[model samples]
Target: MAATALLLSLAGCQCSPSESDTASKGTNAFQRVTGDDVESDRSQWDQVYAQDAYVYGKEPAEVLVENIDILPVGRALDIAMGEGRNAVFLAKKGFVVDGVDLSEVAIRKAKRLAKEAKVEIATINADLNTYQIKPETYEVILNIQYLQRSLIPQIKRGLKRGGVVVFENQTVDQLKLPNSQGIRRDYLLNVGELKELFKDFKILHYSEKNDGKQAVARLVAMKP
Candidate 1:
């Protein structure tokens, strides 16, 4: 009942259910975007990507680059893959990468960046909340600076048996900083919540650190 009410309230903020619904097909059929918050969220991202320059910069995340060698370089998925920086990097390393984000502007920029870098990456303009992750389909999965907790189960199932997952995002400690990004509390992971969430998997690396710029929880794990 509480979940239902929360969904309703969020939907009221984003868009109508009828407006947000995507086609029900294959794995996408079961998981659907229930409200307007998702759409409103996408609009904000689209605005960000529409800027003259890449907001987060063109480089792939440090966490991703540092752990790239450990990952199995086959089919990869980058969720909330803003501008495809990480996806493009994986493609350069010979991984067939698919990057998904809600903003078409971001996808266009990602494609442009991939072209300039002479690497190939498939980009999907779709909201991750309703995006269907095929089971056992990807050898590596990457999530950076994005938090969609409900997608955690799907991420686990989408990996091949020996596949790896690299995730890095702001931790709850960010809220303590004076000039923090003001991220929603719900989106921030607790001190040990990241490793705990993937406890079933073999955790290779886990850390919580604040470099005086940002506070984050990073995790690298592999499915057995």
Candidate 2:
């Protein structure tokens, strides 16, 4: 949920690798920011999640629900899993789920939501900028509405061979929307940038579209 101020309610279209080939490439190089930056980010999210209700609601992201059939049922890691919507959904679907977020409040709420949903999930409160993702650890990784360019490589390495990664986040075009104010530009993806970031993986589904409320980029890819 990095810099995602608005709720996610977008749909994406399917695209091929050739469709994304012309897009500018993205880097996986580590770009560490100041400690203050990390602290500030966590504080803001903590405030948002401290509310009594879920900021993004309890249902799983539509992208994950739509593509569940293609994902393998096994250990799954939900990155920036804020409030455990997707993580809980995965657990209920028979996956052993682990959710990680920067805010302790979010983690607490996630655990609560998991209990309410009658599913078990592990929660870790950590800053992704510095947290280590164990290599080849998960059968599936879910990244929804969060972007940390530097974490891309770690995500790739964290997946077991043949494992899948489901990712969805705001695109630059989201800025054009009236409710897009306050969303950080750096957290937004370029039209084909999401696909470019995971170019090495077998692209299963990729899309960039404006679903009226927000423009988003969604991808489902499998490690070879």
Candidate 3:
């Protein structure tokens, strides 16, 4: 009952059921927009890409770069892949990489990064809130710095048996700013939420800790 009420209150803002069910289909994902304006978020991110001169400055997240060797070889999916740093990194490591993001400019920049890095990557511009993950499609998945709470099931479902998912994101406590980037509290995880979501999978590692800038967690889980 509490969950239902919370979902209702957070509708159109968070990763609730409806968003999870239909995120991929929308050209204009108002629900996924950080705040009231999809055009604004799109323009804002486009400017960020432009300001950086069409290069997202592609470098893998520190955590992902450090643990690259641990990823099992196979098809991989990277969510909210800004600049395709993680995706290109995976490709360099010999994995077939597909990266998805919301910003077309980001996708283009990611492709440019991949080309510059001398690697191949597939980049998709889509709203993840409504994107559908094909069941049992990938062997390894990388989701870093992007949180789609309702994606827990899609991630699990999209992984082949023995598939691995390395997911890292901010926790509710990471909201140190006076106002968050419009990400709702209900959408952010509390400690232990990731572990609990993948409890059925084999957990290679799971940690919830602070890294000075944020309260965050990383989970490496394998589908049974």
TM-score to true structure, per model? 0.83, 0.84, 0.77
Off by over 4 Å in 3: 1-33, 37-40, 53-57, 176-183
Q: Give the Cα error of residue 132 in candidate 1, in Å.
A: 1.0
Candidate 2 lDDT score relative to the true structure:
0.77
Residue 158 local lDDT, model 1: 97
Q: RMSD per prediction, one decimal?
A: 10.5, 9.8, 9.7
Candidates' C-alpha lDDT: 0.74, 0.77, 0.68
Across residues 1-224, which tens digit of lDDT does each residue of candidate 2 receive? Answer: 34323232222212133322211122111111122466776776676566676656677888899999999889999998888889999999999998998889999999999999999999988878788999999999998877888889999999999999999988889778764545567768888999999999999999888867668799999999
As a whole number from 0 to 100, the lDDT of residue 70 in candidate 1 is 95
**Colliding pairs, model 2:** none
Worst 10 residues of 2 by lDDT: 23-32
**Any idea what lDDT model 3 has?**
0.68
Q: How many residue pairs clash in each candidate?
A: 4, 0, 5
What residue runs in model 2 are displaced by over 4 Å at the alpha carbon? Answer: 1-35
Among these predicted structures, which one has the highest lDDT? Answer: 2
lDDT sort, best first: 2, 1, 3
Q: How many clashing pairs in candidate 2? A: 0
